[model samples]
Target: MISVDGLGPTDYERADAARLTRLPQHDLLVMAGARFGDLAPWRHPEYLRAVAGLPEEQALAALFVLGRQVPEGSLPAPLLALLSHAKIVSVGSGLLSADYALVRLEGLTLLAAWRAAGREVGSYAPWVGTDTSTLCRLVAARRTARTALDLGCGTGALAMTAARNGARALAVDINPECLAATTFNAALNGLADRVAVRQADMAALDLGERFDLVISNPPFLPLRRGALGWLAGEGGPDGLDFVWAIVRQLPELLTERGEALVQFASFGDQRGPFCAAQLADELPGLGLSARMLLKPPTPPRWPAFAERDEQGNLAGDLGREYRAYVQSIGATHYHPCVLSLRPGDGGLTIGRYS
Candidate 1:
């Protein structure tokens, strides 16, 4: 048996050296008469059912996408060599076991360094979640920038996407594993020269340079203290800790005519939106202007805000503690939206998104 560790920059490099990225990538997994996006495929019965047949392609998906054990012959020779050299997958009994998950996004294959479900959020490379994908699409639709910054860059999806669109990118995260994962991804996607990784807390960040575009899908979930399974979701009482930190840095982080795109949830009470209205008062004072592309408000999901056990089981009633904390803070609802900021006279605008 070939023992391997979880993914890191070196693992990605080994894959690249083996020319793994040269292979055709699959973005969708078809199973049980249904097609599914690449969100934790191992948990879905549809994916497990598809993997049972062991078709060459789906078997390949089983190795990388589902992080399941696959037959030795499932992938090409080069991939086999890559897997062995990188020690990212274990080989035993003619089967290979991968501990990471890779998914396609914006024409690039992004890999998430695997950690068990109950691990600390920062201990592994984050998979591209809905907010990350939404922000990536928004950035891709916008004009390309000469330079870009992705704060709290989770697997460097946004930065890699920006590089794919013709920009040199700086991918920042507080987690070393995240930085390593981003580094590996940049090289895997052949964007290493265009993408750089940095480890720094966003609250104390000081790159001393501005970018034409800055993007983030920051942690914005509101939760009670000590109720978080992941450090990324440490949004404090109102879930605006990171949001406020990023907003406070915006005036200094963008060049003239440069824009910062942030995806976050804006809390609201009887008065109005929390961050939205607060920005109206603060952005102008900081010589910045803002526009919020608002989506319909949604109640916070109960499971997301509660703590979980090592086995990934919820520790308490479905968000019972979380909901009480939210009510205590006077926030009745939250709007998921992307806030656009630019250097200009103080002004705040709101627009609806479908």
Candidate 2:
């Protein structure tokens, strides 16, 4: 377990670190999942059309990645120092071209950065997947909490964000790499003192602890092998194996007045569409209530969203593997759903976002 006590940067460091946060990093963050070239595995282009036209400092800051470089003597001395400060707190090694291999969330100056999620130990990068941006937003919408727990907190985005919202957060994951990433991100965002990193499997968690809020974005992909390996994204054949385990334990993990925002997925088998409604049915029996926040239905169509990337392009092998994976599990379709759960019973509301 990594300590949260007095874990933030020194007072002097914080003043310098604040300067680096003002750099142009959000454009890169928005384009994270997009691939720029036509080649297989797609290269993450450091220079975008939008970035190429900007001023020197602003352009370099926008498209910076593993090997991109900024012109020397361009930024102020204080800002350059802050850049080094950001890198010192970053973990793993895909090599960051940006001094910090991090990205800012919309409306938040604080960043969530990770090296490419790989098979290396202490190197679990949580690819901020398709629906996670929406999930993070939903998590942020919840009222403040004194203490929060982010179960399976890969790269600790939820926990880091929770800390930003003034909560003491515990980011727990089974992988050491993930815990390390969480620790790095917590420190990177100047919230080390407010976020603790721990290693714990969701099924085996028994810390004798409970939180006022909880958030999770578990691996719900059905593939057991290939891209969905043991390192980061791994859920059994149906993908719900991990989700079911977490959902069963949620009521016990939250406080009486607590609420939780969880991201979920349901795959359609020949048997039936195992959707949010099915999960909501299970929650009531545990003295909990669930409301579906975003579930795409008619018109917009959920399948299109699942098979495409941020740029509305098919993700080559990833898309193919996902479609085949679900078919292997007897599921022809899979759905994305986010739910807000709370202690005690309440009405179940299901919704769809366009």
Q: List the pairs of residues colliding in candidate 1.
A: 284-346
Tens digits of per-residue lDDT for model 1 on 230-257?
6565677677788889989987888888
lDDT of 2: 0.59
TM-score, structure 2 vs. true: 0.69
Q: Cα lDDT of all candidates, in order? A: 0.70, 0.59
Among all windows of 10 consecutive residues in model 2, the one with the lowest summed lDDT is 297-306
Best-performing candidate as measured by TM-score = 1
Error (Å) of candidate 2 at residue 146 is: 1.8
| Number of backbone clashes in candidate 2 | 4
Per-candidate total of colliding backbone pairs: 1, 4
Please give, for residues 1-354, the per-residue lDDT of candidate 2 as tens digits. Answer: 222233346532643545445556444554454543211111344534434445644523442332344454455555444444434232235322442244555433333333331112222354444455676776676657888999888767788777778888998887765676577556556777898877888866787888998888887655453353455465655566667777788767988888887786677543334665567678778888877755542221223213467767447776676556555656555566676888877757666654
Q: What value does the lDDT take at residue 47 in candidate 1? A: 49
Model 2, residue 289: what's the lDDT?
81
